[model samples]
Target: MKIAFIGTGLMGYPMAKNLLEKNLELNVFSRTIEKAKPLEKFAAKISNSLSEAVKGVDVVITMLTDDDAVEKVLSDQDFQENLKKGSTIVDMSSIKPKIAIKYGKLLKDQGINFLDAPVSGGTIGAEQATLAIMVGGDQKVFDQIKDVLKVMGNPTLVGPIGSGQVSKLANQIIVGITIGAVAEAITLCEKAGVDGNKFIKALAGGFADGKILQNHGKRMIDKDFSPKGKVSTHLKDMNNILECAGDLNTQLPISNLIKDMFKSLVENGNDNDDHSALYKEIERRNKN
Candidate 1:
């Protein structure tokens, strides 16, 4: 099927490449053309403009930075005018559920289909094509695009219109909190003269063993805070989670504390580091 892929940044680049590798007729665009250039080797049609990228495509998948970026592209005259009727817009960006619901209705009113299909698994998952894709939209549209999404990861229809975002928020909550827990535990281990690496080894196969403890925990031990997922990005997700909690009249006390820790990381210019850099924040706290 013909497809248009937008936002070829860290996650988007690998995802677009996967689609191209599958021999999908793909058009790719990023505001910065350089970011979209590598896909040309895989036979992707790199477009100079959003209009050029999306025109006549059967599917338009967006993996932008945030809600505003997604909205900006979706509302652009180039995108609006060139997107053909009946084609689906699958927004894989992590955004507010309310915003997704609002745009889903707007697009539906214009004979377009919209899916909020945010993902987990970081840049690594995108590269490995193992992301957990939570989709919120019509079942039929989901079935039609299931194979296409499988080229990147597992796609499951969680609910209608906004559920994908809600599911994503839930995923982020667990990730953020666990990162904090792992960071604090590692700090405690090191301060007590215990090796952080052995700490992880000691916990393997226990209930505490998980992706975060193994993968991200190793990142912490090695001081590898490179941007698998950015601190600023996780901070944004934490903020979204709290906002959703507020709307539901619920209190997420631990998430609130974790949000503050992330805020501190961003304010101190660790925004570009991996979210695992929460280890830095915890380490900073223990310094006398």
Candidate 2:
């Protein structure tokens, strides 16, 4: 199908590349053209503007940063107005579920289908094309697009519009908490004068083994905090989780605690570091 993809950042870049590999009719756009440059070699045409990018495409995919970025881009009159009535817009960004619902309704009014299809598995997953995609939209629409999505990851329809974002928040909570767990576990090992790397290796064959321990745990002991997923990024999702919970009259005490940790992470000027950098915050607290 003809598709338009916007926001070619780290996650977007690899994802769009996967689509290009499938030879789907795809056009890409980035606020900074250089970010979209890598896709050009793979036959993805980089568009000059939002309107120019999305013009008349059957499916518009956006993998942006947060709610504000998502809103700002879709709010473009030319971008929305130019879409065909029966077309679909798939937002894979980690936005609030309620906001996704709002966008769903807004698109519905215009006779367009909208899907909140945020994903997990960071840039590594994006590059590996193995992300776990959680979708929220009409079942029929999801079925129709699942093939396209599967090109980049495994796609599942969790519920109605907004559910994807909610699901993503769940994923983030678990991810953030687990990262903290790994960090602290490693720190404990180091404090006991044991090698943190060996600690991970010792846990590998047991119940503690997990994707986080295998990947992020390795990053932690190695002191590699480069941004596959940034501290600021998960912080945004955690805050969105708390916001969603508050609106729903639910309590998420642990999520609140994790959100506060991320707050300190950003304040310490490591917001751009990988979310695994939660280890640093843990280190700070332990020092006190």
Q: Residue by residue across 16-74, what tens digits does model 2's lDDT show? A: 99999999989899989999988988999889988888888889999999999999987
Residue 153 in model 2: lDDT? 98
Candidate 2 lDDT for residue 66: 91
* Alpha-carbon TM-score of each model against the true structure: 0.98, 0.98
User: What is candidate 1's lDDT per residue for 53-158, written digit by digit as tens?
Assistant: 9999999999999989999998888788888899999999999999999999999988999999999999989999999999999999999999999999999999
Q: Give the true-structure RMSD of model 1.
A: 0.8
| Alpha-carbon lDDT of model 2 | 0.92
Clash number by candidate, in order: 0, 0
Off by over 4 Å in 1: none
Which residue pairs of candidate 1 clash? none
RMSD of each: 0.8, 0.9
Q: Which candidate ranks first by TM-score, i.e. highest?
A: 1
Stretches of model 2 off by over 4 angstroms after superposition: none
